[model samples]
Target: MPAFGLMPISYRAIGVAVLLAIVAGGAAALSWHIQDWRYGRQLADLAKTQAEALNQLTLAAANQQRAEQDKRLALEQRLQASDQTYSKALSDAQRDQGRLRDRLATADLRLSVLVDPSDADAGSGVSAASGAGGMVHGTVRARLEPAHAQRIIGITDAGDRGLIALQACQAYVRALAR
Candidate 1:
């Protein structure tokens, strides 16, 4: 055997060291690739979660809008029904007013025919009474008869009441139309 140094160097040992270094480098590279793949998976999971949350938010907004539309539609229907009811009531009131006017006109005509011509002309038109001895004579001077005066007052009162009632009815109808 040749003289060996304190630390002997051999070709087989050098080869073994080179092989170990190559294996260590390949393992390190594989570890780095695995870490990168794990990072990418985590990012994908985070994006999926955010997308799901956004979808939920969109769905909630759509539902709220639909509810609002339904409410508005229902309100419009109610308003339409109210308008129809008011229109019908107004029409009925108009018909009643027409009938009342016709009846009043007929009553007025009958009353006019029953009234004496002399009595009708006593106030403003030509009087038919003849003056005798400076005393103006008229158809008994309606004011002198107590019974006739009372009856006339009663009739006037009734007419005033009727007019008041008619005015009130008209006002009520106007209010309803509004």
Candidate 2:
């Protein structure tokens, strides 16, 4: 009743199938390990490059900051020097002004005497012979030397600038009278 050319399953064929499956599993595992190693190397290279870039950036930033600090310091030094110069100039100007004021006062006193030599003697007639040219302490002379008289006359010509006011004149007159 069995059909010709029909065969039953063998244990040897099952063993060959199992062997093939094992070989395929080994190949797949090898491929996965290789891919993992390649990816790891790529990641390592990327990290190294990033680290280098960060270091460069940090160095550049430090340099920039130092340069800016130096500029600020230079500006501050210039400002300090300018302040010192300004202070010195102000002091010099003030000194010059004081000198000018003293000169003006002396000129005014000289003019006051010229405009009214009588005012110099006032009611007392003290013979303000505190004489004409410079100052004469004693003895009235019959006449003044031409040059001394000219010098006294010159004081009046400072033209209004050196002349004392009427009030100032009266004050001087009073002071003289005293």
Candidate of highest lDDT: 1
Candidate 1 per-residue C-alpha lDDT over 96-156 given as tens digits, one digit per residue, 9 for 90 to 100: 5555445454553121112355566767443344457564454432222334434544566
Tens-digit lDDT string for candidate 2 (1-178): 3479667658899889999999899889999999999999999999999999999999999999999998778666665665565556555555654554555545532223322455534554434445566655654323444445445444443322233234344544544454
lDDT (CA) per prediction: 0.62, 0.60
Candidate 2 ranges beyond 4 A from true positions: 1-13, 106-178
TM-score of 2: 0.49
User: Best TM-score goes to which candidate?
Assistant: 1
- The TM-scores of all predictions, comma-separated, are 0.54, 0.49
Residue 178 lDDT in model 1? 44
Instruction: Give the Å shift of residue 129 in candidate 2.
Output: 21
